[model samples]
Target: MSYDRVRAVDEDVADALTGERERQNDTLAMIASENHVSEAVLEAQGSELTNKYAEGYPGERYYGGCEYADDVEELAIERAKELWGAEHVNVQPHSGSSANMGVYFSVLEPGDKILSLDLTHGGHLSHGHSVNFAGKLYDVTHYEVDPETGRLDYEALARQAEEVEPDMIVSGFSAYPRTVDWEAIQEAADAVGAYHMADIAHITGLVAAGEHPSPVGVADFVTGSTHKTIRAGRGGIIMCDEEHADAVDTAVFPGAQGGPLMHNVAGKAVGFGEALDPEFKEYAAQVVTNAEVLGETLEEHGFSLVSGGTDTHLVLADLRESHPDVTGGEAEEALEEVGIVLNGNTVPGETRSAFNPSGIRAGTPALTTRGFEEAEMREVGDLIARVIDNLGDEEVYAEVAADVQELCDDHPLYE
Candidate 1:
């Protein structure tokens, strides 16, 4: 983790890197999609495999000197399969979006209809939001969570599927706090003869650890980010049955991406190997418990939780009710000033702009990774409530920052 070599060559970049590490060491990273990887994963990602140009799969590379690259990729693929019980796993996609793109290219033609959860209701941009390439290429429609329950209504979704008759139906979410019923979505997809793609970008580790129901067998395709709930470095993965393995591989290789980031693949390998350990299950379970504790504490402070509470590592608080005058952006700013970091997220039935939405999404994955348990999470929640309750109080901000530093000190990372 030292920057000595970089400092000898480029002092400015080294300083920036050192500063970032310090900042992480100092703050509580509560971002729903972020986690601190182990030093093993970090070292693998920073390894010399970055220079490789293996253009094809293991044992079938187009270039020479790819033995190491092939070994790394194969290990990553095998570990991922073991972690997710996937019939076929592709660790080559550069990002979660890239994995989704590979799946899209493998089957659907341009303008094919896609049915997914609405973006404001916890869907990702790659699920066919107009701003993304998927949106531009595909004909996209959306389903919404029940406004009253703040959860998906399977019957309604089925009705919608029957009405739209989309070529594909995407399950899973970004800010949702409840466990998904993969079978229900699959039944809908089956009725309509549509492909079901479950995007577990936010809960890969939970699914792998059996803390959440997996979509591997029920859904036609599964895609996820390696760096989220999983303590892997930055990467994406795609899983499908053996029937679509060739199509998926071909799409990922020459159709969607050229050369894979082999260093990241190595990181994925190490992270996946770590996840296979029995202790990782305990870690994943703690992540959910911490999230539940955080959500319960926030609720006791009058914050409105989307879906009422969490079954995974994150909680989506709709600030529109409890703090009507305060926007998510304002709360985000104040929280960051106190060294607690998360995101301003859009909630269902959003009435505000996307940038400054009506909700704040807090997660415990990173904090749990830092060795925080229920008690620490509860105190963190109280600190967040204090900040949002007194946004402009400088004295209060200083007090909360001091407490955050104490927590960071107690649960040291990268030591």
Candidate 2:
């Protein structure tokens, strides 16, 4: 990961590249949306396929010299179909946000009603936030989790849907720690005569590996990011029934983007092929187990978890109940100073601003990817609690940083 070849030409760019690689190798990556892809995936993404400008789909092209590109894209689409059990798959969207836009372009009109989860309540910016394109183009309504329980109240969602009939309903979340009821959300969308789109961006790998319930057959549209839990290249994918295939393909290509990222599609093909192996399922299972251990340990340290705990690979802890004096930003900084990396997130019924909120979201996907187990997670949790308990104590931070360094040394990354 030195980027020696890059250094031969542009030393400045190579320095930054090496710096990033070293940063990943040294620190813990607890961000729920982040994960380390395989070296094979990395090679596939940095291939000669990047030179090709494939403007169209397989068996049909807008330019000449697309034979190899067709082979790569076709394999990607077929493997994605197998992994997700979708009748059709589109692997050309540039990112998860792009995939969402494709579905909206296919079925929704300007001023159409969109019902999605609230951003501060474990939702993504692409799910109709005011700053995003979806919010500006569509009439948006939001649903929130139960403030007391910190879990989704599907009955409340159903009542809201009935009151404000929408064109589409978006499920899936960014920082949520529990399993979703795709069938239940489908029922609400069905009762309201709206399409259901589940953005499994964070759990793509888990669902593909059978660690989580799949929304492929239940929801009208399923979108995911290939790079998250899927451990692939950075890109987006859309899955739907054959009835909506053409609409999705057209919307993705001529509608939202021009040329597809063929190299990333190749990487997706390779990564999805690896996921079909039995080992990937075991890895996915360990991710959830490690998260459970992490949440349990944090709870033992007097931290309050959203939804009580996690059934997935992430944990959301509301600092307001546990560390009333320390904000999420302060906790994040203290942890980062000790080489423990995660993010400050807004909790359900949040009273703080989005920039620096009252909650911290952590995950086990990357840690499990680095071969960490439940015991290692418990040790890590103890270190996190120590830092939180002594936020301004320099001696505690120094000791924790040394311990974190030892952990990083034991479980080396990208070696």
The per-model lDDT (C-alpha) reads 0.95, 0.94
Q: Which stretches of candidate 1 lie over 4 Å from their true place?
A: none
Per-residue CA lDDT of model 1 for 264-370, tens digit only, reads: 99999999999999999999999999999999999999999998999999999999999999999999999999899999999999999899999999998999999
Model 2 whole-model lDDT (C-alpha atoms): 0.94
Q: Estimate, for each residue in 171-267, the C-alpha lDDT of model 2 and write its tens digit.
A: 9999888899999999999999999999999999999988899999999999999988878789999999999999999999899999999999999
Clashing pairs counted in every model: 0, 0
How many times do residue backbones clash in model 1? Answer: 0
Candidate 1: the clashing residue pairs are none
What TM-score fits each model? Answer: 0.99, 0.99
The weakest ten consecutive residues by lDDT in model 1 span 70-79
Which has the greatest lDDT?
A: 1
Scored against the true structure, residue 33 in model 2 reaches a CA lDDT of: 85
